[model samples]
Target: MNTGAVVRLTEATGVGRAVVGGKAAVLAELSVAGFAVPAGFVVTGAAPDDPELGGWMAEEAARLGGPRFAVRSSAAAEDLPDASYAGLYETRLDVPADRLAAAVRECFAAADSPRVADYRRNRGGDAAAMAVLVQVMVDAVAAGVAFTAHPLTGDRRQTVVTATQGFGEALVSGQAIGEEWLSTGHRATLSRRGPARVLTARQAEEVADLARLVAERYDGPQDVEWAIDRDGRLWLLQARPMTALPPPVSWAVPGPGLWMRNFRLGEWLPEPGTPLFATWLLPLLEAGYLDGMQATVGVRVPFRWTLVNGWYYNAPPVPSAALLVRVLRDGRRRAVTILFHALVQVGRDPAAADRAVLSALDRQWREQELPRYRRLVTVAAAEDPAADPRRLAEIVDQLGRHAGIALWYLAIVGGSAWKMEACLTRFARRHLAEVLPDADGGAQILLRGLSGAAPAFDAHAVLSADWYHPVAAELPTITAVTQSGDDRQSALAVARTAAEQRCAAALADRPRRLAQFETLLRVTQRYTVIREQQARTFTLAWPVLRRCARRLGQHLAEIGAISAIDDVFFCTRPELDTTATTDHAALTSAVAERREQWERQRRIAAPLTLGHPPRLIGDVIERTVQRARPAGTTAEHGSEVIVGHPASAGQATGPVRIITDPRDFPTFAGGDVLVARATAPAWTPLFARAAAVVTDGGTLAAHASLVAREYGIPAVVGTGNATSRLHSGQRVTVNGTDGTVTVHP
Candidate 1:
């Protein structure tokens, strides 16, 4: 135990990593810190040809009381922040004291081995600057590695341990499978139980504690190797920095209430949402609802409207009563000021506020926004407009403005529709459950009665036509008016019967309440129609914009600014703007690089909540209305049963048809269960042919839910990963009322 060419592991402090190497430095540090490390000596410098090395080994053997020792390569580059040589280096185990010098020489010579050279070349490391560590090897009862954090999930709160019997080298070298355990605080759970349990619960906790300590000392996660001797004594063999940890996620909830992804917005944004869409377009839509609440109730409720993982999340605002009170007071004062102004200007125009709301709803998009869009399209369709950069710039400006107008109105209609739907749902839950029995049935009855009044019904009819297509310049009209009229009459008759049967008892018992409910229901229907109209109108603009983008893309391709026309989507708006003046080679390279990055992003699942979703609190009406089912509904007993919100009520079993794009529609056969990431208005036509509907994102008021209710197909929405989980042609049973999809093996 002396400081020489070979220093005792415990006494080797202040020795630089370049001399004793990264592994020796860590071991020495652990020994100095009073961790249970084995007696060892580090042979510093190059190959251990020194005559003193043999004498030092003999002295170490006498102090440790054993001839057997493990000689390990500890290169300067090993266990560094960027490089963990790991199994790439040599380890000669159970070397006799006489062969210790030869073992050290062999360990050093491993630096020049072909495999080590290849590994260094691949990992971009220098040739190993050799040092050899000789230690009194433990005869292990159980041995393995532990991580202070969940490596894959990057969950810092948990420690993961992988253990197997015998040497940890077997597990590390992938020669043996191991049992896995995840520990947090005093709790430890076995994730994978191997043939034999390697460690007891208490032992696992002890290991986790030690690992956590090492990780803390290192100021990051640590990959620790440990051995539990037959006598139950724990020994630390190696500890190094964990490499390539995923970036730590900030798990703070956006607000005080749980934020969930809504399919209404998510369906429209099927791919990863772009910043422009999330920042510019989505906020405008969210503001419409927030503003509407302020106008109607004198309460300016805030919303954390954001995109998480490219999906839209409806986050509740801060739960501050003082903030709410202040907003209410301001809203009330503003309302009083408006009322007084209206009285002064028009001598008590009582309906001024109503007129104002009506005006907002009735603004003529066709007269103002659509005309500009049309003009742009007309100009862009003409030959070689690249010569006129100013004209193109004007068209781009017009396109953005027009799209904004469309989005603004769409948000207004959508937000209003959601409010109305929530009201209806709340009323049904409070009053109509006893009479209707089935909430989905009741909704269908009400919806069918108002079918003639909903533009969505007409739109569905047009969409149902065999030749109908979304990108068509003009939507097809119902040419067979007589047949449509007959179909409507039949549907109305059925709807009337269903409604009468459901509402008769309620109406008889509470006539006034029934009348009030009827009025609300009618208003809800009107809002629903407006929502569908705005969605359809807004969608029409997409084809126009898409055409323009493609045109520009084609021009860029001609100038060699991109590999293909579709590559334009990979470029940001500003990058696309540069195409007007930037050099072709630079633009092309940028687009190609961006395309690669975009493809990589598409593969990652975006977290539903940026941080942990906020905890539920208070008696918020939104929470009550959004519940998919009554409390204490028993979960279906099956491993394959996927739970989701019951959007539409029915039961059906069919082969799954996973549709990510409309282009995949032809693959959908009748009686197939449609499994989609989300569904847009454009996807409505598929409902008519599908036996059941399952979506990754949506709520009761989402387009898929509404359409599913209309089609009377069983639907479970907001499954979060239905498209990924359910494979095409896999048979499954969907229970919409139970909100479960049982996959068949």
Candidate 2:
């Protein structure tokens, strides 16, 4: 095998990896396959010390008709299936022809660089043979890297492209930020961490097309480097097998069963959930719902739930024997069983179920739970964790139990409320169309009328005070109850006036069904108020749990089980349980690994449902949510509108204030349209000052919805990406009645 020291990349036939190296071989193959690779030649390790290499370089440069050349390292170990020596070796670009030989030597020398050596060692590879690839430099207007499959989440249907202006070096070296484009096919969606876009939609799709071609040719997903020259010709700079491809994802097609996401428990848990929390919390929740169903319906239906990309999702339950028998007897029963299991579980009477659940909650609140929770809150506040760790743990346990009970009722409340609303909407639309033409309008009127009776309004007023500025701390001991009383009275007065006016208009001229309408109104108000009260009460456990977790975190940090107190969040419950009393190096490593995983998960757009997330511009629903602008408009200009469920009935246009973390609460200004992943009860205070609200996750019965309705502000919930799509200072008009948010340029 007397292969020459130098080989023309286009004519490098039968060149082995050991000679031409992995990258040069791939380029050679691509060039042969007719890809738009810049004309280049490879200089093997045999030529690294050859004095005549300079003559060869000049000939190649002249043949390519370029004064500047790119000298890139193509080590044998580079771009391996298991490892990508990306940015570990030297790549010298825009080198004058006179310095091409020196650049080649520099590229060859990169094989011995400490970083490359360490990288290879880590991957269990021996020293790599160096081959330098010299190509005519393409003066790029834009350059970037693209993956045929989504680099994260491993969705093969999507292509992820990241590009920046001028050169790829800036993006590769992390010196400058770049715009990201996700291309599914012909359509491309553009997103930016910073405010500049380097590639247009057409350009992005073109780049993605080239990448897909490379991947198809290679017979697997490819990580491709691409550039567009000043004349607008797309060029493939390099291509390599994608390393560490995510395991194949099996997406479930939408089916007949009930698929729940961004509703009930989903709204409260906005981030990618920690494993420990998911392990303990999800099962308990499932059990609670199961118990409720068993108690009400006398049959056990599986209430299975799972986390997809860290978001809670309830999987469609397996049909029970009773359900199957019912289906055989009546087709309508099957539809009802699949769609409205909550109603079926509660004897198929939503109003009765509402009454039963609300009555039980009222009794519990009055007899035992409310007083016990209040006393515990006082004890938790008064006794410092540092002074009494045992007592602190005991209080945390008690708080958890209280929260669990509340959650059980919340499950009932959420299900019953949804069923009740569905029934009410159906009845109003069918029977009361002449009296209340808009079913939603009729429901809104009833909700508003019931608002005056809600204790949640009083809680909101009390929470709005300065003492509650830091909600994470234990509630302050009220030295004087008069201020809260006066605020409550004022709130009640305002609510009562609004309710009376709204109810009068709703009931005006409905003489035939007056009594029935009034009965419906009373039931709707009672359940709606109870829903709000239970949700608020359930959240009280969160601050306590958070504090307990922090304390545990501190203990771990003091004992050197983890590096920091907050790192405890990254550990699994089992890991925490075992490592709490013992110090282990693996625990630290695991925490660090989990932190990285969490950071990556943050970048992923979790699918709205477990199976197949809606794809917009080739990316999953999660990734596209932030980048989604109104259709048929560019980011700089367009009348892009986002549609969601209208939770509150009003309309307002204002600058958006994107709040991802509660710590940013202080920065919220009066009248700013609040945008977040989701809002909890702790977020109630912001609603008071917000002109409108938009969220990526929530339902008509979500905390944000209830609060927004009470505040009489426009709110659109479950926009699925409002937090990611809308930026602070951008003006958006939120129409709660229409459930649409139109972004203004």
- Highest TM-score: give the candidate number: 2
- Candidate 1: where are CA atoms >4 Å away? 1-267, 274-390, 426-435, 449-493, 501-510, 579-590, 611-640, 729-731, 743-745
| Ten contiguous residues minimizing lDDT sum, candidate 1 | 460-469
lDDT of 1 by residue, 18-103 (tens): 88888998999999998999888888873355667677778777787766888898888988767787788789987888888788
Per-residue lDDT over 1-745 for candidate 2, one digit per residue giving the tens place of the 0 to 100 score: 1237788888765778888889988988888888999988899999966777777767777878887888899888878777888899899999998898888888877778888878778878788688888899999999989988887678899998888888798887878656677888568886432234578788999999999999888799999999999999999999999998876444463453434567556666667676546655445555655554443444455655666655567644454687666544544443344334344533245555545444554566646766776677667756645534456556655655555555656765544554465455555655555554342343454455344333332232222111112243333322111112234335644664665455556667776555555666566666666677666666564555566667877878888898987786777656756775555788898888877776666656665554442233232223223222222333222226677766776679999899875557677878899998777665666765688999887776677777676556788888766665567887889877657888775
lDDT winner among the candidates?
A: 2
Shift in Å, residue 214, candidate 2: 2.9
**What does the lDDT come to for candidate 1?**
0.64
CA lDDT of each prediction against the hidden true structure: 0.64, 0.67
